[model samples]
Target: MTPGRVIAGPGGGIPWDLPRDRAHFRAYTSGKWMLVGRKTYEEMEGWFGNRTPLILTRDPSFVAPVPSHRVVGSIFEAIELAKRNGIGELVISGGAEVYETALPYADRLVLTTVETEIESDIHFPECRDPENWTAIHREVWPSDEENDFEIILQILDRKSR
Candidate 1:
């Protein structure tokens, strides 16, 4: 996401190409159970590798291309499925709506804040309330040959009530 919280540009695609960020994402998400919206799932097709995808969609007729992928109706259902599969952690990789819907139940948030802002229709939901979350980890990376912009990678954990 950008400094403005923009996740995807007006064209409904990510504006920046950051290989370092991509590698970071893959490092944390590989072999994990990922929950994503239908559009996000389609956009990220063939990128799953060893990870399992739980696609959230209201369409009952929608079927996943991969035999291992699961289509679920809601976030809770996705959680239940992951629990049944003995998954200890579920990663929420999202489009806008999915992020908004899952925000309440999120225990931790892994975020990459790009230094620049771009024109975007999709924005990540606000979850930065100081009372609700604490930044447990953060790393600042400067632009490199592979990455166009500086980025702040952060891990925020939900504060206990």
Candidate 2:
């Protein structure tokens, strides 16, 4: 999932018009299993219909809307479940807390640098340490009438430690 460059807006959530980002999001997530935080899952409304969802929440009594979806209490449990299901490449989509939790283990990150800066309480963690990350791909999207902000999409791969 693509987090805003500033992570989120003043409301502590992403609040911007980004059609191109939406397109990019669909392109990557379509027909894939998504590992998402509970809050993030709740924020979505009828979106991501094509993907399987694994919701991570600390509440053991939590229930999922669909029977096909699974809920786990910890990231470790999620990882274990993903492994048992033979999920080869895991994608950790997030809320800031979950992003921070997954940072050390994340093999790759799809970062979309939103051009315009806006106030935000939540922020994406800095991953610029050359020893840990290396940019594998980069593309710049200019702003347009449809999307009010320009964005730079970058793919970062974690270096073998």
Candidate 3:
């Protein structure tokens, strides 16, 4: 089943774990994506080498470690710049705020319910209405020797579109 979009056009979500969000953008953005957080921005510089990244931040004095990236004033501007690239897909890698901000824009969710419940200071919002979306595809994987939990991958699609 199609989890979202036309199955190819627009954007899709994938559940992944990287110490920094930059790795996610670098690994994914050969397709054009916007890294949506301050830490995600910092992590990209060292991890992505010299690839240009677009960072979204409202703070005016936010100085980036690398000039290959620019801090945009808003998510709208960041997305607009990414759209201008005309690359067919965008990945919204999160740090909570970015995910919440972009959730309304997504038609599909590439989700990974981690094998272990992380004691995170922040958490991803839950989908309360199952009718709004469906898990078209799912997979289970072992977390690792350190973790006894199992991770679940779910691809969810919007019902109406």
Candidate 4:
């Protein structure tokens, strides 16, 4: 979340602008296995080619696109699948619940803080503590014709246990 703690507007609408999309792609989405909640996956249509999708849901009969995606009942199952597939970098592309579930174990957070005040129904977890996390990368993107607000991309790494 940005200083305002807004991630999505009502009905899962995105609050960030276009430049943030590209920044997000470079920072978190490319060449990674993304663990997403069922609603999140559904919102995304299916899966994108750059990253594999692991859908996490409690619905036992939930199905995902064949040969490319799969559904997991728990985060443990998702991690185990990542291990089996030899995925070193995993992305938790979230809808609120999944982010909260993975927050404690997440090693890094790639956040694009948009400088704007907007109402939102879903908020990113306020679990980041300045004392325990370090910002390793920071880039500021100014608003242009295509973007409404300035965006700051920060990659935060949790301090060693």
TM-score, predicted candidate 1 vs. hidden true structure = 0.96
TM-score of each: 0.96, 0.91, 0.68, 0.91
lDDT (tens digit, per residue) of candidate 4 on 1-161: 55777778876757566765566675567778999898888888644676788999999988786568878999999999999989997799888889989888789988878888877758888875668999999999898898888888889999975
Give stretches of model 4 more than 4 Å off. Answer: none
The model with the greater TM-score, 2 or 4, is 2
How does model 3 fare in lDDT? 0.57
CA lDDT of each prediction against the hidden true structure: 0.93, 0.80, 0.57, 0.81
Cα deviation of 114, candidate 4, in Å:
0.7
Q: How should the candidates be ordered by TM-score, best one leading? A: 1, 2, 4, 3
Instruction: Estimate candidate 2's alpha-carbon lDDT, on a 0 to 1 scale.
Output: 0.80
TM-score of 3: 0.68
Worst 10 residues of 4 by lDDT: 19-28
Output the TM-score of candidate 2.
0.91
What residue pairs are clashing in model 2? none
Please list the residue runs of candidate 3 whose C-alpha ends up more than 4 Å from where it truly belongs after superposition: 1-31, 43-45, 49-52, 144-148
Global lDDT of model 1: 0.93
Which segments of model 2 are wrong by more than 4 Å?
A: 1-5
lDDT of predicted model 4:
0.81
